[model samples]
Target: MKTICGLDCCGACDRKEACGGCLKTNGRPFGGTCVAAEWMKKGGKDEFLRLKNNLIDEINSLGIENLQIADLNLLNGFYVNLEFTLPSGQSVKFLEDKNIYWGNQVEIPESDRCYGLVADDSFLLVCEYGCGGADPQIVMFQRRQAGTEIKKQNLV
Candidate 1:
């Protein structure tokens, strides 16, 4: 079976043996009290599975007929520049980047802190910071179409 890296999917943490994260002690990535895990477990297995499917659906709905992967730079993080057309006939240029952290939770740098963007499909993009007992802030952004008079939806 094929597997995705720790990027979009959960993988066995190399630091799990010595790390103090719940996943490290539990031997499973999803079953933990971590914020992300807790969010996923809120409604049990079905909800978690639904959330995963929703993420996949959002990616597919982007209709990425073509995709390009850019060079990975440690300082700049891993980036991918996407040029794709939306179903509404609008063209979109999206840049996505991923940074890895070995701590118990993910943190977004102060410079990167901003309101999150949520897709029409309910998938959210936000900066997650802190670990263990730290409370993460949920930043929200407004997404809008160019030249359209419609008000943008406040993403949460």
Candidate 2:
């Protein structure tokens, strides 16, 4: 029996049977204290802007269909970031990133974790500047050095 746009985050949201998510309320989300909402207002938007630009730059440098980004799976008390993607039956996942977190439980391992992009090259990509507690960072090589420095974790 959840109200408030059915997302249960808003204290006074009354939009029944519908939720605008990040698009509604001017990218403000539904709740005032909502992590995603607060993040967008504070600095997440700017981070995303940078990531978009970086992704564009990466695409420009590596060609549109030459590279692929790896997927991430997160888990909290109640299955956060469930990797249940409806397969598109394609060879590559491309730039498809689904980040779903809420700051309740945050545990990111630096070396032992699934990579952000396809692990084919000698260099590993890391989101040097993470956007939010939930959003994925597209910026790579901000702190990590080039070459086969960090070992890749097999997320099979």
Candidate 3:
């Protein structure tokens, strides 16, 4: 099986040895829960798709220039997690290396950089990075407002 998130699991992942793939690991690859797998397992594929589509809508509505998102794929945290330097000079990573989240990549129109977007049920993270994900910089990180949570009851 590719993935419970309805996306190909082996597309571009580099942690297959550690992850054993989502299906082989029973949805808990890397010894942690994948938000996409958990949601899809709990509420079914259609519900999970709704949640993902809703998130895409939310990201688009942010009015970020050149960030018109089309879809969010199931991304392993280890692949998309990049350390970001804050204004205070402290660097931090907002994602767990073992968890899975919904994310996408959008290239800047006139630059060599690309925008990386990662989101779970609680927050939205936007970042820019160079080729091979070098020099990642945080563009924005926002806590998803109230009433936007996607749980079992919220799936409908």
lDDT of 2 at 30: 27
**C-alpha lDDT of candidate 2 relative to the true structure:** 0.31
Model 2 agreement with the true structure over 17-38: per-residue lDDT tens digits: 2334444544333232232333
Q: Please tell me which model should have the higher lDDT, number 1 or number 2.
A: 2
Span of 10 residues, lowest total lDDT, candidate 3: 147-156
Query: Taking the tens digit of each residue's C-alpha lDDT, what string does model 1 give over 78-137?
Result: 211223345686765433222221111122345432222222222233323233313334
Which candidate has the highest TM-score of all?
A: 3
2 against 3, candidate with superior TM-score: 3
Off by over 4 Å in 3: 11-14, 151-156
Error (Å) of candidate 3 at residue 35 is 1.6
lDDT of 3 by residue, 1-156 (tens): 487667676667766776788888778999977888887877777778777778888999988899998887878888888988888999889998888888899999999999999988778899999999999998899997665555564444
What's the lDDT for candidate 1? 0.30
Error of 2 at 103 (Å): 25
> Candidate 2: which stretches are off by over 4 Å?
1-17, 23-45, 64-156
